[model samples]
Target chain A: GDSVTQTEGLVTLTEGLPVMLNCTYQTIYSNPFLFWYVQHLNESPRLLLKSFTDNKRTEHQGFHATLHKSSSSFHLQKSSAQLSDSALYYCAENAYKVIFGKGTHLHVLP
Target chain B: NAGVIQTPRHKVTGKGQEATLWCEPISGHSAVFWYRQTIVQGLEFLTYFRNQAPIDDSGMPKERFSAQMPNQSHSTLKIQSTQPQDSAVYLCASSLDGDSNERLFFGHGTKLSVL
Candidate 1:
């Protein structure tokens, strides 16, 4: 069975600092789509970024993620963390079906 | 438009009882998916339907879980003989098509509690 692993369960960063939530996956499918989704408190999760091509960086709403097949990683990154960036982040890999990792709770301290 | 509408934001069911959750997908979307989220499992795909037809149900637990998309507008996930392990938030999501990369729009999930 395919699986996704998010190393960071909770990440805290000061505002204006760099942000990174580690995500790695193990799957047998050759062509897999990786994605990052953000869920605000009491809200549904929304797509933040997705990657279908290897080494291509996908960005949305000040967040970006690059899919690296060689490393089996799609780590989410942001240059400057914002107070508004605090939320639950989920990393997923889509083969014929979607598999999501345990989410990372990001807290950007102002 | 209301993104995705899931009825009964919360539900409580007793052990061995039946529980049914409903979802109304976004208009004009042809792909709908059901997922279960728990602290232990994170998020797990239960089933998906394309254009009112079930494309794959391989992820579903066959003995206790069933899903049906009778029409394009809505779908239902029913659990018979619910157990404590079945208590979790059930999420419904929709996409434009069956393409794996299509961005999914999710509804505020229904939180189920099996006592």
Candidate 2:
């Protein structure tokens, strides 16, 4: 069985501040592909970033994440948050079928 | 490309009625997946097909839910005697393959409301 965990249910940040959304996963497979998906209001989920090489950082749309296999973590981070950054973020593990986390709602306030 | 296309942007059905949802995967995509989304369950995997063949359906409800992929272009998910608890957004996604490395492209989804 494979599972993804996002510890924070909600994360609120002021505009221009840093952003960090924690993600972790558990799987029996040695090489697992990790992905970050973002969903805006009234929109479908889209891929933000993905990584298969452990310890290498992959980025997209100003968001970045590193897949640390030793720690089993692939946390999303951004240097500065904008109001548009507010959305639902899901961390997923593509082991057998894609297993998604509960999701973290990011609310960036101006 | 149109990405994935799910018919009936919204579906309202009476309890105990049957509901059939349609999904058209991206052209040439080898894998098609069905998922249920809710506030409680972020994204619950229902089933998936590869090369128009049934693969894994571990998350689907055995009695009331069934999915079929008769061809490469289309797939259908049918719910018999739908319950109120089945109200959620049904999403269809397609990828180059059901493999671990590929990314999924999702449809707008069909919002099912069981009244």
Candidate 3:
């Protein structure tokens, strides 16, 4: 069985503050593929970024994440948080099937 | 591309009634998956089909839930004797294939409300 862990509970920060959403996973596969999906209000989840190669940073929109196989972590980061970035973020491990983490609700306040 | 299409954006059913949700995957996708979303459980995988064949249904409830993919174009998920706790958004997604490298394309889910 595969599992994904993310930052628990709601994360609130000022609009201009740095954004960091922690994620870690456990899987049997040596080369694991991980993904970040974002779901806005009343919208379905959409893929923000995905990575397979270890230690390689994958960027999409204004966010970036690097898969660290040694640590089994893929933390999403951005230079600054935007009000529009407030949403539910999910970290998923794509083994045989996609296993999602309990999402983190990010609230960017102005 | 049309991504994925789910019918009846919303559904309302009595506690003891039955509900059937429909999903139309992308035109050429070989993999179709169903999931239930709720505040408490988050995204829960229900079942999936590959090439019009059932691949993994371990997440489905044995007695009340059933899924079918008679053809490559569409799939259906039927829940019999639905309960109040069965209320949640039902999401359907499709991918080029069922492989790990393929990213899923999700549709606007069907919000099921059981009274």
Candidate 4:
């Protein structure tokens, strides 16, 4: 079985501050594909980025994540937070099934 | 593309009643997925179909729940004897491919509330 873990239930940060959302996963396969999906208020979850190649930095919409198979972690990072960045972030492992994390609620304030 | 379309944006059912949710996947997508979203459980996979066939339904409850994909165009999730705890947003998504790296297009979802 595969699973995903998101440590931050909620993360609060001021605009322009650095932000990081922790995401880790476990799988039996070495080349497991992981994804980051963002869901805004009253909207469906949409893919933000995905990566399977370990150690490669995948970036999209000012956010970046490096899949570290050595640690089984793919931490989402952004140099500066924006007001629109406030949303529920989900980390998912695409194995036999799509195992999604509990999600992290990020609130960016001015 | 209309993306994925879920009928009855909201559904209200009495406890012990039945509820059926409908989902129309993208025109050509072969993979369709159903998930239940709630604050307590987050996103929970219910079942999925590929090429109009039941692929993986291990996530579905043994009793009182069933899913059918009679054709490639539409799928239905039926819950019988619904309970209060069954209240959650039912989401349907479609992907060109089911692999982890493929992009999944999701519907607005049907918010189900059991009275």
Candidate 5:
């Protein structure tokens, strides 16, 4: 079975600091797609970034993630976190169906 | 486009009762997906339909959960004998196609509460 894992249940950081959300997946499919989605309070989840090419970095809205087929991971990272960056982040593995992780609640403290 | 549309923004049902959630996918979209979101589960896939055909429903519960795409315009997810554990935000999403890279457009979701 395919699955995705997000190690951190919650991540809190001060404004202007760096942020990283760990994501890993396991699947039998050879060509897999990975995605990061962000959901704010009272809003629908929106795509932040996605990658299908192994080892290539995909970025959006100041956040970036590189798909590493060797490690089976696609970790989301941002150099400097902003207060507005606080949201729920989900890591998903896309095959015929998308499998999502438990999600990481990012709280950027000002 | 109006994005994905889900009717009855909220639904409340008693235990042992039945509940149905409606979703209207974006025009011209070929794939419709149903997901359940909870504080504990975060988000979980329920089922999906492509071109009005059931593609994959492995994520659905063996019993009590059923989904149907009677036509290209809309889909419905029905839960028989709803229980307290069934309470969650039911989200419907659609994409231009079932391609892995395509972005999914999600609806506001229908909040189902069972007591």
Candidate 6:
């Protein structure tokens, strides 16, 4: 079975500092699609970024993630954390089905 | 568009009772997906329908769970003999197709509690 692993269960960063959420996955399918979804409090989870091509950086709403098949990782990163960036982040891998990580709660302090 | 619409934002059922959740996808969308969310398990895919036909139900638990897309506009997920373990938020989403890169439009989800 395919699975996604998100190492950080919680992340806290001061505003203006860089932030990263680690995501890794295991699957036998080639051309796997990776996705980042953000769930704000009381809101539905929405797509933030998705990548199907290896080594290509996908950016959305000032956040970016690059898929690296060599490392089986697609880490979400932002140059500077914003107060509004605090949310639950989910990393997913899509093959014939979609596999999601447990998610990481991000908190940005002003 | 109104995005995805799921009815009965919240539901409560007695143990062993039946529960049915409904979802209306974005118009013209060809793919519909159902997922379960919980504090411990996070998000889990349950089933999906492409063009009103079920494509994959591998994630669905046998015996108690069933899903149907009678038409292109809506789908239903029914659980018979609900249990405490079945208490979770059920989310429904729609996409343009079954393509891996297609962006999914998600409904707010229906939170179900079984006592």
Candidate with maximal lDDT = 2
TM-score of chain B of 4: 0.97
Q: Between which residue pairs do clashes occur in model 3? A: none
For model 1, which pairs clash?
none
DockQ-better candidate, 4 vs 6: 6
Expressed as tens digits, the lDDT of each residue in A1-110 for candidate 5 is: 99999966789999999999999999999889999999999888988989999889888989999999999999999999999999999999997688899899999999
Error of 6 at B110 (Å): 0.3
Candidates sorted by DockQ, best first: 2, 6, 1, 5, 4, 3
Across residues B1-115, which tens digit of lDDT does each residue of candidate 2 receive?
9889999999999999999999999999999999999988899999999999998999899999999999999999999999999999999999997888999999999999999
TM-score of chain A of each: 0.97, 0.98, 0.98, 0.97, 0.97, 0.97
Compared with the true structure, what per-residue lDDT tens digits does model 4 show for residues A1-110?
78899865789999999989999999997778889999999999999999989899999999999999999999999999999999999988886768788888999999
lDDT of each: 0.92, 0.94, 0.93, 0.91, 0.93, 0.93
lDDT for model 6, on a 0 to 1 scale?
Answer: 0.93
Q: After superposition, how far is residue A50 of candidate 4 from its true place, in Å?
A: 0.5
Regarding lDDT, does 5 or 6 come out ahead?
Answer: 6
- Tens-digit lDDT string for candidate 1 (A1-110): 88999965679889999999999999999899999989988888999999999999888988888999999999999999999999999999988778899898999998
The interface RMSD for candidate 2 is 0.7
**Per-residue accuracy of model 5 over B4-113 as CA lDDT, tens digit each:** 89988999999999999999999999999999999888889989999999999988997999999999999999999999999999999998888887878889999999
**Predicted structure 3, TM vs. truth:** 0.98
Candidate 5's displacement at residue B34, Å, is 0.5
Q: Any runs in candidate 3 off by more than 4 Å, and if so which?
A: none
Report residue A75 deviation for candidate 4 (angstroms): 0.8
Q: lDDT tens string, model 6, B1-115?
A: 9999998899999999999999999999999999999878889999999999999999899899999999999999999999999999999999987788787889999999999
